[model samples]
Every structure is written in structure tokens, then in C-alpha cells.
Target: MVSQPHIVFLTETWLSNKIPSSLIIGALPYTILRFDRSSRGGGVAIIIRDYLSYSTVTLPSSEHEITCIDLFHQSAYIRLCVVYRPPTYSLSKSESLITCLSDIHASSPHPIVIIGDFNSDSLCTHPTPIDRLFLDFQISVDLTHCHMFPTRGNRCIDWIIANDPSLIPTISIVPPFPSCDHSGLSFSLSSPQSPSLPSQIRDFTRVDYSAFFNYLLSVDWFSLFCDCPDIDSIYSAFSSAIHSAIDLFVPYRTPRPPSLSYPPHIRRLIKHRDALFSKVHLPSVRILFDQCSKKLLFEIDKWTRYSTRKKLSRVNDLYRHISSLTKPKLSIPELVSPQNLPVFDSISKSNLLASEFASHFTLDDGCLPSLSSSRVPPSLSLFTFFPHEVYKSLRKLSPTCSTGHDAIPQIIFSKCAYALITKEFQSALNCVFDWTQCNQLSLSASKCSHIRIGSKQASPWYSINSTVLPLENNVRDLGAQVRSDLKNSSSIKMRAQKATSKMFLLLKALPFNCPSILILTKPMFFHYLASPFWNPHYSSDIATLEKVQHTFTRQLFYRCFPSPDYPLSLPSYSDRIKTFGLRALTERSVIDRTSSFGINIELTTSTPRYHSFPVRISRWYSQLPDSIRTAPNIRMFKRRLENHPIIAHLAKLT
Candidate 1:
């Protein structure tokens, strides 16, 4: 009520005559019109926002609890009625309610909206007389409960009914109010709003690297930090110098407009339809509204087909966009502390969730080896920071990557890679490390995890700073989850499911039986639709992925040719490939994986066979023909393999 809804209709408030209005609607910004039972357990209330001008309408009969109000908004009146019929109420009471509704309809020339918990499930075989009465009144009742889960038992007894169905607004069932079994319903009459613009971001790819490096070189570091006595002072001076260089060289750029949720043409049609609907009472306006609505729907269908065809031409981009749009939203579970006490407030819930995660990750210090007793290798000295090693490390950091707990951007580190190798930077790094070690200011050992990928039987545990960091069977590293067995079955299955979902969505968007367009787009669909599921770096069993691709292809074939006996006339996998110029998943994966690595196959004995790039390359190399294998150099061998008829054909698909 305090949030000031235009009109709120509450049923079964359970307020008796004894409970005063001041107690129920205390300090709320609403004018209430309620029908209360003289005894216990049956009541109805309609709370209108204070800004709205409304008057209570007296019913001819008061056999059942009902609240009627005529609300004035934007120079128009709307007859709002809230009804609550007790289960024990007789058929006569229902008839009386319906008669009151008829009287109100005859008196009010404006649009009418009736909302209530009629305590009748219209879908039930034994329909109540109240339901029949509503049907007789020509009222449209929406029995589709907004809540997916049960509000009370398994039935949706509450309904929002309107004389004109279109006036019944969009309703959302939010979480139940405290101690209430019924979920709260929030609704709005307005049409959906357009999506707001995305935030502006810098285009780092367009940065002038040559100008940036030249600016860095021009900076006289010795002159700027001549008076600095300590490592900290030198670090500050260097940071300022690098930032100045960056500001001079790096220019900001605005990206192209983001994709609209609804196409502009469709939005225009919807606006036109809504405008016509507003003047629906007039005979001319009513006819035009009907025509406009039909036109709007036809345009939407036409646009959907056009957009689907366009997206199918660039299927990879479509899949990526859909994946981003359908990414799972994060929601916090009901927070409960270790003591089993429930937390209600958002701040408390957030803190409890963080604490629970911390507790799960925290390790026992007693289980770890003492740091004092541990031997430190002379070559692994923290005091010395080699400029070349520092430069290499900084260069490896991705400029577009996320920041850490320190809130320092990766671009800052990447831009200053050259400066990091300087003597002053090295000294500063060593000083920071020494200070951290002395004061125990490093990240808590409990907050960090150590993962060892190997056979499950031989999984290893690790310790840091005398605290044993917990070992995990699965750990997320650089966005991909790594498992102890090193098998990519789970990852492959997840990717396949996502791809299948996206394909189905695209199929739904496109019109069926457009054989010419489907044929033209088939190759593009296979090439890019499957790209999301194919990861060159991850080793997935070829047979599993092939099955997924084969299933998708078969479904696509059926869609394009929807005859009942289509499968009987369908060609074999190889025959279809030759006819459609489609490549097998195994060949496509091999070609893509081989091409990604190029000729830089560095074999290391220490690397695990499953994860080793050289091992994979060697396996593929063994399958090559003698002509490709006999090349004098790695570069020539790669060229020959890439140009081979089979590999070249498969590469074209990718």
C-alpha cells in the first residue's frame, strides 16, 4: 500500500469488524474501501493510491463481500471491483454478486476490471455456480496463475477478470508476503517499454600501440624520480609516467548500437495497435483496432521469418547472441547460518552467503607443513625480480580480462610491461613481496584452492603458509572447468545441450516448408551452429560429438522436408555429405584443432598425455599420408597437410 499502486484488490484479509482501519492501513499512502465480515475469517479490501480520484459504489445487494470503486485516471473512469466469496456461501449469494456486477456494468460506461479469489477452480469437472454466473456475465477470467509453484495446495482459485479482456493487465506473482500462504500479485496496464542503451566502453583494439610505445620511450624516468629514495616512491613516479603516456596515445571510441530486443518495425506496429485500442469504444475506432491488430500480427510473423533467414546466414553470431541472452541469472538461496538461523534482510543474506562460501573453502592450519621447516630453493629467491621474467609475465596477462581483489585492471599491467622490467619496477615488486611476507598481508590460504589434475586415485593435496588448501575434484580455470580425470565428457555434453537448445529456438523462429531458403542456409547453419559446441583446445570423444551433429542434421532435414515418409527416402550420412557438401564432425574437429596449433608443436615429457598439445598433434600426424609426412620441415609439413584434398575440404566448412 505504501508503494502506492494505482489499485490493489486484496481478498481474504481475515480482518474482522474489531480490527480498525488505522491498524491495518497505518501511515500507508492509500484510500481504502473494504467489505468486512461481522464475524471472523472473511473480508475484502481495495486500496487505491492517494493520487487517484475514486468514489465507492454501493451495490444493490450485499449478500456477499464485494468492494466496488470508480477510479478516475487520465480523464477516463474505470470501474474496479474486488469480490471475495466464502466457500460456505450459498448459490443465492453468488447470484446476488452477479446481479450486483450487472447493475454496475449498466451504470458505468467506462471499462470494468474485476479481480477476486472466487474459491472456484473453473477447470474442475464439477464447476461451481459462481463460475457459471461469471460466464453468463460475459466476463473473461484468466485462470492461468502467475505462480509456477503452488500458492495454496495445487489449485489456482484467484483470478483477474475483465469485461474487455485486453484491459486485464500483465500480472507477475512475486514472493509471498511474510506469514502469508498466497503469493503477492503485481500488475501494470501499460505496454512493455523499450530496452535502455548499453553503457559506453573503450575500444582497446583500436589503441595506437606505436604512439604509446614512443610516448613511453620519450619519458625521462631518471629525471622524474631523481629525488625518490624508496621503492614505494619510485613505484608512484613510474605509475604516473605510464598513465600519462596512455592518456596521450589511447583514444576512446563508441561501439555500434546494441541489438534491440524487438525489431523497430514490430515495435512500430505494436505502438499503432495500442493507439487504436485506446479509442476502441467508437464504432469506427473498433473496426480500425481490429484491422490494426491483425496487421501487427502479420507484420510480426513476416519480420520473424526475415530475421531468422538473416541470422541463419551468420549462425555463429546468432548462437553467441542467444547464449549471452539466455545465460542463467544468479539468484541467492534462502540464507541460513551454520547455527541454522534464517537471515531475512538482503544485506544479512549476502553476508551469510559469503561467510558460508568462506567456511566451505577454509582449511585447518594444523594439517599443513610448518613454513619454517620447509626448504626454500636458492634459485627461487623472492628478493630478486628478473626484468625479462617480469616482462614476460605482464605480457601474458590479457588486456581485456577482469580485475582481481586489488581492483587493478589487466590493461594497466599489459600497457606497462616494458616499464615492469626496469630496475626500479623490479625493486618495487620485491619490496612489496617482502613487506607482505613479513606482515602476513598476503591473500588468506583458505581463500585460495589448489587443484591437481590426474587419476582420481592419485589426486594430491597441497599446502600454503602452513595451511592445507583443499583439493577439488572439479575447479574452474580461465572459464573452463577442469576435472581430475581430464575427460571432457561433461563439458562436451553441456556444450551439445546448449547448441541443441539454440538450434531449436532458431527452428521455432523460422517458417517451415521454405525449401529453397533452407537449402541455401543449410551449409551456413551446419558450419556456424555447431561452432559453439566445437572447442579445439578441449579433447572430446569424436563419436559423442558426431552423434549430436547427426541428430541435429536429421532434425533439420525433417523440418525442411516434412513428409510423413521423409526418413524412408533420406540418404545415408556419407551420401548426404556428398549431396549437401557437408563435412563429418570428426573431420571438421581434426582440421580445426590441427589448424589452431599450426606448426608450433612443442613436445614435453613432463606434460600429461591427455592435456599435452604435442601428443594430440603427433596422434593426428600419424594418420597423415606419406606425402604430407615426408615434408622436410614442420612448416612444409603443415602446408602439405592443410592443402590435402580431405583436410582442405573440411577446413572450408569451419
Candidate 2:
């Protein structure tokens, strides 16, 4: 089913009405119909691929143990049915079954395929009264049995009887499913062909960054922005410059289509299994082939687990691996309109999502009082941006930061900031909300969010035009969450929870059959699970992060080394972490992250009155040794600390 067969049918499914279709199929792209028995056991189901147009057929009441679907393929309709009859059912039932088939053959204006377990063996060779009746009916209806081999126990009890023999070329029987007696059958249907579609391709690897930078350097900044009267004009010019550079330096080429290839181990296993199946026909040899098939399946499962574990061992690689493995999620949160009606259509749903987001950030126009006088500074009105100053500011911008709503890179605004652009930017924003005829732009109120750094009482409400903007406790900016309290506890907790979930998953997925491999992979797994939380530039309470790390480490240790005598002389948690060659989430490590960001504490004239991450980091930095304190920069200081391991350890103690 995962390989996406065109159609599937099952008999003696034992599925009851109580079982939902979602539980049975679960997001597979298929339309299903089932005929469940009133009592326990003996049921049938038919599923057709979603790409094919299909509908349920209203069968006669005589077809009690049957499920049927009509498939529309290439301007022609085909009736497909699945039937199941228990061995305990009376021979008289065959009369109704034959009548149902006769009626279907007469009524359907298309080819018919009837596949099922009839519980009658060798009907063509040795016929009972009911078997002889079916044989006579088959001759009259021009039906042919497609199954050449026995479906179960040296008897052709199951069948694929089709009205048009040309529809099916050949039927191949595979081994029986685990715990099932009947063999699985596969057949290819002749269908109309369609032309292949060409796909657009881009090769980003050929981009020349050096050429791009040179192009950027050659652009005349003064000529572009000197006469620009508004922020929009300046933004337009900056964007044009970057885009032209990209167009010149980045080469776009269409490459040949990619070929699908399996992993080497899986390919080898498949080849081995095929060789065994092709050469061996003896009963003992067939059994060996079946065993080989099972072994191949097991190897594939093990390889998948091993590959997942290996990729998840690195924090940077975990997201990509998880994304590739994740199934398309169906449980989207339902959106409702203001009138309490469900939004189903894509356009309405999008509008609802936007409205919901706006509701969170928007405040009533009457919530805040208007200002009595002009609040804009006198000096800000005369401030003009210089090209040189803008260039310097842009250089300070982080290359990795994301682009803004205008599709302009953050570096552009960062560079613009050097020439007192903040005042101009605010003026431009105000112009957009002035509601005058000249107002050519409008900002999305929902997309904009603000966080107050001080006490709520001290903070004043902000508004664009008459609409007051809602205040937030924390808001994500430049890829990191900035909080009013400036503590990373919330961020750290989120990371810890995510890591803990992945760690538990790893524990559950580890193969107990290979303990040596598990032992070897433990350190890699630990690093993969824990590194993301600590690597990012965030400040968390050391004790809190340590507790989270400790919990995960303990669980991992117990799973990897599950011996009764192992903890008789219980070692310290830190010692156990060392034994596993894993790094501990210590207080010093947390402080070091802040230090790496070039935060200086000794420069502070007074102790910070408020408890914040920056204040805490400053305090930690002031207490460090002079060698670290007087280092040229954050990177150099980090390198020094890395070199003097004993000194760094002692510094943590302080």
C-alpha cells in the first residue's frame, strides 16, 4: 500500500463496522468501500487509488458478502468486486451468488473483474453441484479464471475471474502474508499512456560569491540613493543593486533528470533474494527463498533505523532527517470565521488565519488616548542619510539574518541605520499610517509586534494612527526570542523538551540485538540530542538546564548499560556523563556562551538593578581572569579559554 498500487482488494478482512476508515487506511491516497459481516469474521474491502475516478456500485441484496467499485479509466468504466464466502455457508448460497454475477454482467456496460476466496477448490477439473453451476455460469458470461496456480494449500480456492481477458496480461502469485494461508496475487492492467511533463531546475552551486561581492562594490551608492526622498525609494534602489549583482554572478542551468537509486545494502539484499527466487522451485528451496525475503525485509528496517540514528547524531543534520521521514500531517487546526462558521475553502481559510493573527496583535482604537502635542524630536526632522554611513552600517549586519516583508535583506536596513536612519524609518512608518492621499504604503498591523523591556506600569501604549498595538511578553526577532525579562529559561525549556522527546525515541528505536553498536553510537546520540539546546546564543539558569541534561543522561545510561550489578557502587551523575564521553551542561558553559557574544561586564559602572540575561552575563564576565578579560575579542578569548582547560575549570568554580 505504501508503494502505491493502483487498486487493492482483501477478503476475510474480519473488519467490523466499529472500525473507522481512517483507522484502517490512515492518510493513504485511496477511496475505500467495505462490506462488513453482521457477526464476527468474514468481510471484504475494495480500495482504489485516488488518482482514478471511482464510485461505489449499488449491488443486489443477494451479494451480501461482496464489496464493489466502478473505476473510470481513459473514457471507459470497469467494475471491480471483492467477494468472500465462509466454508460454513450453505450450498444454496451459490444460487444467489450466481444470480448476482449474472445481473452484474447484464447491467454493467463495461468490463467486470470478480476476485475473491470462494472456498471451493478445482472447480474446472472436479465440480460439485455449486462448482458446476459456477462453471456453466462462467461459460455463459464469457468469464475466464486468471489465477493459474493454487491460492491456498494446493487448491485453487481463491480466484480472479475477469470478463475481458485482454484487460489482464498475467497474474503472478507471491508468498503468503505473515499468519495468512492465501498467497498474494499481482497483475498489470493495460492503460492509455500520457505524455511526460518537463520540470524547471536551478543550480545554486554554480553561484560565484566573489563576483557577486565585486559587483556590489562597483555599484555607485550615492547615485542610487542621494536623491531618494522616501524610504521606499531607498529600499527599491538597494534591492535593485543586490538583484543585479545576483543576476550577473549566479549561473542558472537545466541539468538532466535525476535517476532513482536504492542504498547499496538494500540493492544487494534485493539482488540476493531475486537470485534465490529465480533459481529455486523445490519446496525446501522455496522455504529458503521465503526466509531470505524476510531477512531482506529485516535488513531494510535495521538500515533505516541505523541511518536515522546516524543522521540524528548531529544537531545540524537532525531537522533535515526528521523532515524527510515525517509523513504529510493531516490534522491541521480548524479555522473559524468571526461569525463562528467553519472556513473550508483555501481563500476563506487564509483570510481566517490572517484575521486570527490580527486579533492577537490589534487593539481597539479607543484603548489609548491621542497625544496632545507633537512628540517627534526637532533634530530628527533635519537628519539625512549619507551613502558612506549607510555602507558602514550595512557592513555591521549579520549575513545570516532573514529578509523583511519587502523582500529586502536585513543588511540593507542595518547599513541604513548608520546615518541616523532609525528616525527616518519611524517617520516613513508614520507617513504610511497618516491616511492622507500621499500615503502610498501600509504596514500589516498583525505582522508587527513589540516587547516592553521594563515594568508594565512604566511602559506606555504605542499606536499607529488611532489603532493601539498590543504589547507582548516575548517576541521572536532576528531568529531568536526576545523577552521582557531577557531570561532564556523559556527558550531553554522548549529546547530541552524537544531534545528529551528525540532521546526517548532513540532509546525505543535502538536494536537490543546489537548491544555493541548501541554502545558505540551512545555518545553520538547524546551529542545529537543535547547539543542544539546549548549551542545557540541564549542564557538559561545553569541549574535548570543541568537538571534537564541529567534526566536525559540517566535514562540513556540505564538503557545502554542495563546490568543489575552496574549501579552497586553508584557513581556521580557527572562521572557517568564523563564515562559516556558526553559534555555536561555546566554553569560555566552557559556563561561562556554570553562571553562568546562579546558581552563585557567590567565596563559596567554599577551593578544592574534589574535581573536580565545581559546583566547576569556582565556580572559573570567581570569575575573572569584578566587574561580572558583583556583578550582582543570574544573569539580570541574563547580560544584562550579552550587552551587553558585547567584554568577554565577553576574559573567555573569561582
Candidate 3:
């Protein structure tokens, strides 16, 4: 108690039901959570400080001697478990305890720490059954038994295991407590640092791009390292020039000052109170100072509470209010089939239960009743023509044919669109204003852009609310690129560049192992659209996309297998794919398309066209086997697709 330890875990408490926890805790404000076996000399207890918000967790499946608690702070929690395995522990008891620990570790959002007095010496010459089990558990769950020193005498029975050892940086063995035989294990769990406001950054928004572009052009990029024979020398020289250009053009931004917490009136009152305190020697000043101090304290307290409540009401109160209204009434337990066997797999159980539940109900055929003499709902139709398109149409006209309306010849107007363009543009603006006003909203000028699509290079300036928009040749919408000429070149190029930058960033920042690398990159293969972009239409685009995966696999190979292959030619992409047992990006795209098509085969669209999703994927989707198409869930669909190899062989349509 004098040491003021935040928490204390004890094993072999030797206390029974008659000994209330309060008697042991005494007058200290601490929570004593105990899990006692029916017999004596086998119990676990955790004494946590009263201030921490925490709850005791019980494992129904685990009948062994173990206790767990979740110490929470805001959104994050740390799960601490205490274990006590007797020297006479059975093989069956060890398995159940280890299984319970594994479950807790897996379910926790943050890494957990487990400390115990297992009495199984880790430094024993011959490993016991419990020791073997612990070793296997450590390997399977990626946990570490960090304690190496002896706890009781020369044999180390006490252990401190954690799912992530890096979290607990400092580990030490301290002398045993009074009347205690086992030594104490002291360790600290490091919390991740809270995010801080950035003090400085390159201000790219105000960069002079024109000068930067000129600087880049002036550099002899093609003549990089002409005397050197290696590609590394050329790449290094090229990178240095580009980096210097960026540093010169991009300006650094100054940090903004922190805002004042108190309002103006409260701050003024505080200053007045402080000024009075300085003149406390005078009797009148003392009286005024005391009054002002009280009032200032009241106002400060009110403002602080208001500010805190306002910040929390936006999230915490709303979630709690909503959760109270929608409480779950039913819970499904394990189901047994007619054959008296329990349904263990999630997919099979879900399908069986859904079918059983639906057997008691009926659904409508989804057909509307026919009516006589019914009027169709009216829909407002609008037609639009680009100004450049109108100019092009006028250019194809003959000068001999005079314009019917406005009495103007086509040749004069075709020479320059100034006359026709201004009147038409004003009319379009009026329509836009009317539409936006009717909707009771104004479009953001920053969110809007003007672009001309198709092969024509004719682009006219467009404005919203008297603000001219910057013309863009290409724009990315919903993570898919759209270009002026509808070419895949810019779209694929941007995607490859992003993928390369993201891949290297992940590799450099994260401390993941070899297998974790593939897991991290698994989510990046999917292209946003199910359109032609899914299957790159051009040969160059396909090569560019495939190279991302190839380069990744090559990097992974170099990291895993060490050899004198630095200057040696690496294996081909196909051989590497076989070596790593991974499918190609194009192959993955087909699988994705096939599964999507299978799910939406019966879905009908009003404006179905040749380039529509279902129509485009029909070729690949139609060839899939019935088993894969009929799969009930994503997991089953993936499992079935893996068994079928012909889907990977289909040539992508250009």
C-alpha cells in the first residue's frame, strides 16, 4: 500500500469463501477480484486500484485456476490475466487453460499480458507435458514467455508472457515479498503516444509549378551518369535532381498558434481577480479580491463543464441513447440436425438455420397488379449539347446555306464561336441557377471541375458563381480515373504510381514478418470498378499492373531467401508466382468478376448495354462450374473457386 502500486496479482491465495476480500484489502480503496477453487491452496486474485474503470471477465469453458480483467481507458483496453497451475496439473487441465488464454488474446483489440506462477521450471533439462504445451502455444499464438530468471530458488517457475513483447519494454526480477517464496516479476506496458499536431510541413498548395517544371526540363535527365555502367548510378543521380527541384519550389508552412480555452468574459474576470490579489495588503482590496476569486472560480467551473459536455455529447451520448432503444431480444444457440449431429461450421449452420426458419413462412412473387386506364408518371426530360460540339457542327455546314434562325450565315459563326457561345452560355447559367435554387443548395466551386470528353481538343472556359474553374484533362472519381479522351493510359499510370508508393511505405513503416507482408498486400489487388478497367484493355496497361505484383513478389523473395543473387538475374514472374503459390493479378480479377456475376446473374437493369457490368462479365461468369456459382457465401465461393483451375486460364478480353 505504501509503494502505491496500481495493480497486484496473487496466486495460491489459500483463502476460502469465508474470507471476505474486504478483510484482505483492509481500508485501501482497491478492487479485489478473486476466483477460488472449491478446495483450499488454489485460488487467483487481482487487486486493482479503484480509480481505473475496469470489469472482471469470466471464462465459462475454462474450469481451471485463472482470472482476467479488462482495464479500460476511453476507447482502448488492456486484458490482464492471472494463472496458477499446480505442480500436479493434469494434461487435460493444461490444454483447457491454454485454450482459454488463446481465446482472450485473439479477441482483444490490443495485445494482452499474462503473468502466472506455473511451478513448471522453464530451465528444466527434460521438458514436462505442461512445458511442451506452453512451447507449442507460444509458437501457434505468436506469444513470448519473456521471464528468464529464476523466481523460486534456482528454478524459474514464475512466467510473464505477452502476445507482443515490444509493448512491455522493461522486465525485471525483484526480491520476494515478506513470507512469500516466489520472486516478484515487475514490468511496464508502454502505451502508444497520442497524436500531436504537426509543427511544420512542405506547403505544396502555394508552390510555383511553372518554375519547377522549367527547372526539371533544364536538368540533363537523359544524360544521368553516362560514365557509370550500372542502373543504380543513373537512378541515384536522377532522384537527386528531382529532390532538389522540389525543395526549391515547395515552401514550408508556419505552425498555427494554439487557441485559448476560456471565453473572453471568463478570461477578463480571471485577470481582474489576479490584479486584486496583488493588492491584498489593503483591507478594501482584500475584500474585493476574495469576492472576485469566488465568482471567477464559479464561472471557470461552469465553462469547463460546458466545454467538456459539448465535446462528448457529439458521440458518446448519441451512441448510448441509440443502443438503449435497440436491444437484441433473441440469441441463437448451437443447432443440432435431424441426424443428431451438431452443426459446427459457420456457413453450413447459417444455411441450415435460414432454410429451417424460412420453411415456416411464405414470400410474395413480386408482381404488381394489372390496372385498366392507368396514367404513367411524368418525368422531366432534358437534352444537352457541348458548346465545342455545337461549334464543330457549324464548321461542317456550307456557307451557301444560311442559318434559318437569327438570320446568320454558318461561315461567319463557324470562324469564331464568340457570338453563339455567349448567349448560349448565359442561358445554361440561368438554368443551372434555377435548378440549384429550387433544390435549396449551392454547389461548391472547389468540388466542381470542367472537362471535355472525346477525341476533340476544343475546350471552353466554364465558371460557377463568377468563379472560373481550372480545366483538367483527367480526374479521378470514386477511385476510378476518367480522362478527356477516355484513354486507359493516364488511369493505369496513376494506379501503378500509387501502388508503388503505398507498397514501399508499408514495407518501410511496419515491423511485420515475411508472411505478414503478403497478408498486408492482399487488399490492394482489387481495382475500383467492375468495368473494362478490371481487365486492362491495352497490353501496356496489363504489363504495368502486373509489374506491381511481380516487383512485390521479387522483393518478398529477396527478403526471405538470402543468396548471391544481387547481380544475378531473378526468376521470371511466372516461376515466382509458382514458387510463392500466388495467383496473378489478372487471374484474381477474373475470379472477382466471376463471383460478382454469379451473385447478380438474375439482377435486371433498365438501361442494360454492351458495356454494362453483367454483360461484360458474361463470358467469364458463364464458364464457371455450377458448384462455384451456387455457393451460398463468400467463404464458400472462394473455397469452391480454388478447386476449379480452368477459370484462371481464360484469356482477358482486350
| TM-score of model 1 vs. true structure | 0.37
lDDT of 2 at 147: 71
The backbone clash count of each candidate, in order, is 0, 2, 0
For residue 359, give model 1's deviation from the true position in Å.
23
Candidate 2 to truth, TM: 0.39
Off by over 4 Å in 1: 1-158, 161-449, 454-470, 512-540, 566-570, 593-613, 622-654
lDDT (10s digit) by residue, model 2, range 33-85: 78988888889988665556566667877446888766666656788888886
* Ordering by TM-score: 2, 1, 3
Look at candidate 1 and tell me the lDDT of residue 515. Answer: 49
> Model 3 segments beyond 4 Å from truth?
1-426, 430-449, 454-471, 516-521, 524-534, 567-569, 596-613, 625-640, 651-654
- Per-candidate TM-scores read 0.37, 0.39, 0.32
lDDT of 1 at 594: 59
On residues 577-647, what C-alpha lDDT tens digit does candidate 3 reach at each position? 87777788777666666666334343333232343445556756767778777888877887788668775
Instruction: For model 3, state the Cα shift of residue 321 in Å.
Output: 32
Error of 3 at 105 (Å): 55
Candidate number of the best TM-score: 2
* Worst 10 contiguous positions by lDDT, candidate 2: 324-333
Worst 10 residues of 3 by lDDT: 375-384
